[model samples]
Target: MKTILFKSKLIRLFIAFLIFASCSKDDESSTVDIPTVNYTATNFDATFFQTGNSTAPTIDWNGDQGTFSLSAPLAGLNIDSINGILSWDKTLPIGIHNLQVIITNSAGQTVKNITLSNPLQGVFTGFIINGNSEHLEMEFFSDGTIIVKLEDSGSPPTAYGTWTKNNTTIIANLTNPENGVQASFSGTLTIDTTAKYTGNLYSNPNLTDPLGVFEVVLH
Candidate 1:
């Protein structure tokens, strides 16, 4: 009887050990490894133009195999799930847009924020006619800052200014750096075949008695 009891105890111990080992293996197999997701934009700051129809940018993605989708329904924009790419329609509004892209895999999901900007921001070159025609360079920033410089043989002076747009109408106020004299400009901006601005410059703050006419096209 003692030998039989001893064998029965040994069997119970072996059974318990097997049960514990099996539970450990199951727990290890159930764990999921999270994935890392990232992407690169072809355009700096992911900026795009609304000049033509069906414009898209190649966005290189790096990560585990996953599905791509937009966090929200972005108007005038679409994305491909198989390969992450962003395409824009010409109907995209002219402004700053905050967008989010979601990537999902069996491990989990990650969301990335992207900013798209479409602004009348560039260097414009043309001529300003006062008494004589002089070449001028005007730069418009998205933050409403304007830099005006006259191109000449010597180091021409630069004028710092602020500009505002109301529909197609544009108003700019500039102060000469060399002298403290202030000037104002009012114009109509056209963005059709090209970005062109035609305006009149004034020497006075009130914008009375036009100084000259100017035309500049954005590159």
Candidate 2:
């Protein structure tokens, strides 16, 4: 009877040990819970235009802290990985460029498209005047300042003035200090495969009589 009781107690101890070991193994093999990522806001649908100078628009984003990356590398743009701030100190090319922005965390990833464009605010050379090549250089500043220089013309051939645009109609008021000549130009800007602008030059601010029609193309 003593031997039987001892064996029964030993079996109960073995069973308890097995149950504890099984429970430990199950606990060790359990899967860890990962946090789900949720993006509250994103600037993916925003349109950014490249300024002629070193200034650029800022991209704002609000979401979970994750990694940020661009689909392809841009020439002069910089993107903040952790904060999602996009900035650039130089101008990009003209036309529409689609950028894919990717955000990823331990949970998942989110992707969106960002459009970048450069309008007609840069240095344009190779002016076509009256079906002839004038070989002039025109620099359009972002601050509405325009500077025109004659490539082959002699000294004091530069004109400095202010320019304003309403839609496709561009109005420029320029003055030449050498000859005290005030010139105004009115034109329409069209952007296709290249930027082509056609307009007429006038002498007065009212833009009464046309002097000559000119067209310029951007490279």
Model 1 Cα lDDT, one tens digit per residue, 57-171: 3333333466778888866677777565666764454566687877676777767777777665778889999888899888888788999997655667789998887676788
Compute the lDDT of residue 128 as modeled in candidate 2.
Answer: 39
- Could you tell me the lDDT of residue 124 within candidate 2? 67
Candidate 2 at 23: error in angstroms? Answer: 26
Q: Which stretches of model 1 miss by more than 4 angstroms?
A: 1-86, 89-93, 96-117, 152-155
Worst 10 residues of 1 by lDDT: 51-60
All-Cα superposition RMSD per candidate: 8.2, 9.0
lDDT of 2 at 135: 62
Candidate 1, 23: how far from true, in Å?
A: 40
Alpha-carbon shift of residue 53 in model 2 (angstroms) = 17
lDDT of 1 at 156: 73
